[model samples]
Target: MPKIQKRKIIIAKLIVILILLTIFAFSCDSKKPSSRGIRISETKTYEASLYRQNCAVCHGAEAYGKEVDGKQVPSLRFGEIEKKTDQEIYEQIAFGKNLMPSFKGQLTDEDIWRLVRFIRRDLQGKQQ
Candidate 1:
């Protein structure tokens, strides 16, 4: 093969390799866990939005429940939530209790699960 033709082929191979490497890097990054241990692609943005819109009023924006009258509304943070199992939390979210409303028809199972995850992992900082 001519020297110039060989050089061109080598350059084309290098370009292909570089492109593949770039794609591999990005693909790996997409699977990386965020500081909260959730995948970068699986961020709690949607769940957080759901919490803000649905539960934040009673639970407070930070998952710390607000008081009504002279009673404490209860906080979803660490110590307060540590008493309940994930299943219990799921049931509560699905069924509702007292002033809290049921999210069964409004939110899907997956959405509720995501909220549970956000509350447990992100808000309460529980390790899985």
Candidate 2:
């Protein structure tokens, strides 16, 4: 091959390789930082919005609890919540307890379960 033609082919190959490398680097960059990492799934995001709109008023923003009608609403972050099984939490939310009102008709069973999971996992930091 002519020297100039040979040089042109080499440069083209190098450019192609660089382009591939750039693509690979960007593909591997998908991992987010650990601190900012955990993405709330669509379900969890919906559940969170549900909690905030419906439950957060009494449970407080973080389920830290708030007062209602001279009564102190219990915090889901506390020891009592930890002791409660998922079923119990689900029932409480569905049927209501103390000042808490029933959500049975308003919220579906699945949504109640989502809230239970949110409380246990997100608020209480429990794995399950």
Candidate 3:
């Protein structure tokens, strides 16, 4: 083959490889693990947003808890949160206690459940 033709063939092969690589990259599942190290599902995504809007104020952005006044606000990071079952946590969120306010009317059952999952799986890193 002529020098020009060889150069053209090499360039074409390079272009083909680039195209295949781009397709593979795009085709690969984009569902990445979140900053919390949990794989974010649709429900989890919504739950995370809810947590930020509703719960983050007292719970801290990472659900690690914050101190208010002279008292330490309870953290959802670990310990007690991990010990509680899904239903128990749901009740706490729905009914409220002490400083925490009830979310009974504000959040639906599904939203609460997703919140529980997010707290357990994402914040606490507990396996469901």
Candidate 4:
């Protein structure tokens, strides 16, 4: 076929492959808890507002976890996140891990630290 047609076909295949990979990558076990504690909208704290803007999408507004189309996004409030150190949480926010995107450039160090505190203090109800 023509070069233009061949290029289009290649692009289409690549797009399909990317989509499939994304779906597979994000897919999680269905047995995990669907929803539990607080709803994101209920919390009125500044930290909660920040979380609503940045993390509520994947983690759900309440941090109780979220599942979309069989894909399970882990909850900050329920998982081993509580076991993690403040530094660990801070690093995860600064530098993304697995499917979580990094917020290095998007948020300042202070903001990221605040988020860490928000998760620990506000969401988890643990004093630092």
TM-score of each: 0.61, 0.64, 0.63, 0.65
Instruction: Give RMSD to native, each candidate.
Output: 10.9, 10.0, 7.9, 15.8
Better TM-score candidate (3, 4): 4
Q: lDDT value for candidate 2?
A: 0.77
Model 2 alpha-carbon drift over 4 Å, by segment: 1-44
Model 1: colliding residue pairs: none
Give the poorly placed runs of model 1, Cα more than 4 Å off.
1-44
lDDT of 2 at 98: 72
Model 4 per-residue lDDT at 56: 85
lDDT of 1 by residue, 1-128 (tens): 99999999999999999999999998788455434433322345887788887787777666667886666778777455779888888989999987677999999999999888888887767865
Considering only N, C-alpha and C atoms within 3 Å, which residue pairs clash in candidate 3? none
**Which residue runs does candidate 3 get wrong by more than 4 Å?**
1-44
- Mark the regions of model 4 whose C-alpha exceeds 4 Å error after superposition: 1-39, 68-70
Q: Which TM-score value belongs to model 2?
A: 0.64
Estimate, for each residue in 1-128, the C-alpha lDDT of model 3 and write its tens digit. Answer: 89999999999999999999988986785664444534333434777898888887787766667887766777787657767888999999999987778999999988988888888877777788
Tell me the tens digit of each residue's lDDT in model 2 across 19-81.
999999977784542222122322358778888778878877666778887888888776687
Compare the candidates by lDDT and give the number of the best one: 4
